[model samples]
Target: MKNWIIIFIVSALVGFGAGYFIFQDKEEADGTNQTTTQEKESKQENVVKEESKDSNAPKTATTSDGGIFSEKGCISCHSVSALNIQGGATGPDLSKAYDNVEGKHGKPIKEFLKVPTSAVMSGVIEGNPLTDEEIEKIVEALKKAAEK
Candidate 1:
């Protein structure tokens, strides 16, 4: 009985250590996500500052339409750092989409803006088309990321 008790305790300790390590790694991953978002925000601030310094530079809209996108349930398939992604769906990571658009395709923002969410990228959790404005805001966020 004593030997069994000892074995059980040892097993429990090993399980606990494994859980601790896994959780610690998860916390680190979350931290990295936060850091990435912060870096993006910082880069955006720099761009705004530069644009402001150049009076002739075209004005970039800072108004966040992220909420509207979230409210419309875009988060069901996409994630925006400062927006709703609680029920985020199984879509291709939007993180790299911008580069595929501008860098690879060499498409203008307006042309890139014409993506039909249903057809351009597959593996979406479900079919739900976003409004033109919502697409613009999401595209804007993507463009900002591309610039970085």
Candidate 2:
């Protein structure tokens, strides 16, 4: 009886410790999630403010950082008309990319903006697919199109 009681006590202690650790980890994860959400919300607010400031401004065919598609040979796969340099249509029609990235298909605009070429192959042609600047410009262009 004494042995059984000691075993039961040990088991209860172990379970309690496990439960406490699990809940503690869960609380930490929840706090991290909250922090990330707040950061994203702040970033979105900034983007909205910038967009509103430029709403009345003319829609420049180029992003705030010039025409990256043309400069980076993206026009080979995509076309913006004015910056014509047509090539293969291996990729989807990018002219209407704004529609896809927006909530038109239930995808958050920010999520879509974060990864413009997510649908595209990770590596095509050469090893390097896209530079950070190129990706940023693409996201910016998408944002501009979404605003329109």
Candidate 3:
């Protein structure tokens, strides 16, 4: 009986220690999803750069239809933070969306945009179809977003 009691206590302590070790440095679980100080500063710099973009300046990757994504209501559910976009939390954050364009959706970006895999997106796309040019521009924007 004494040995069993000692063994149970040791097991409990080990389990507790192991749980703590696994989650000790997990910042994602700490709820640090808000914009960090570095990200804020980076945004400020980007704002300055945007302001200084003249016709002669080297062009940054941008969607040809500047507001097409929002105009067509993508921002209603999706967002691409790297594009300085924010949207409702109905869908995944598209910060690194281009990384898994094919693997996640089982199709290329252009095709996915034209024919969304998700039912929700399918409805959205049905209501607001994107032109070939618009899809091309959006793909460029996604590629640019992935670079960051």
Candidate 4:
């Protein structure tokens, strides 16, 4: 009888200790989530203010970086922080992507941007092709960013 009681007490203590460890992480995660949400809200507010500054501005793509990229809709899927632009995460950052990246059809960045063989990019280019002037600017921008 005494041994059984000792075993039950030990088990209860172990269970309580395990429960404490598990529940503690959940509380920390909730706090972290709250902080993340607050950060996102703040960022959204800044974006709203920027947009409100130009109410008469043309509604372009998903992002408004106020450059050739935004005008050409590249900012919808790509961002070049080196060019001080913020865009969607659906595509890779083009900051230093001179020749380091490729297209779905195995073409380099320049070729891909010029022709856009990828199914997604094919449709995009079909709707709005990149002009030679715009392509020159983007390629030069990428080269400069990569050099840095």
Candidate 1 ranges with C-alpha deviation above 4 Å: 1-65, 81-89, 102-131
Tens-digit per-residue lDDT, 20-106, candidate 2 = 999876664455534563564466445434644786743323434236664454544554432222324666545556566454545
lDDT of candidate model 3 versus the reference: 0.67
TM-score of 4: 0.51
lDDT of 4: 0.67
What pairs collide in candidate 2?
none
Greater-lDDT candidate between 1 and 4: 4
Tens digits of per-residue lDDT for model 3, 7-124: 9999999999988777663443343647553564466446435744765653322345224555555654677777766555788877677778789889988899999997767866
Ten residues in sequence with the least summed lDDT for candidate 2:
119-128
lDDT of 2 at 105: 40
lDDT, residue 115, candidate 1: 49
lDDT of 1 by residue, 1-148 (tens): 9999999999999999999999876664455544464564466556546765876764433345334434444444565443222324465445556667566556654455554334434222223445677667777776665554
Q: Each model's C-alpha lDDT?
A: 0.53, 0.52, 0.67, 0.67
Off by over 4 Å in 4: 1-66, 102-105
lDDT of 3 at 108: 85
Q: In model 3, what are the clashing residue pairs, if there are any?
A: none
Off-target runs (Cα >4 Å) in candidate 2 are 1-66, 81-88, 98-120
Alpha-carbon RMSD of each model: 12.1, 16.3, 11.1, 12.2
Better of 1 and 3 by lDDT: 3
Output the number of the TM-score-best candidate.
Answer: 3
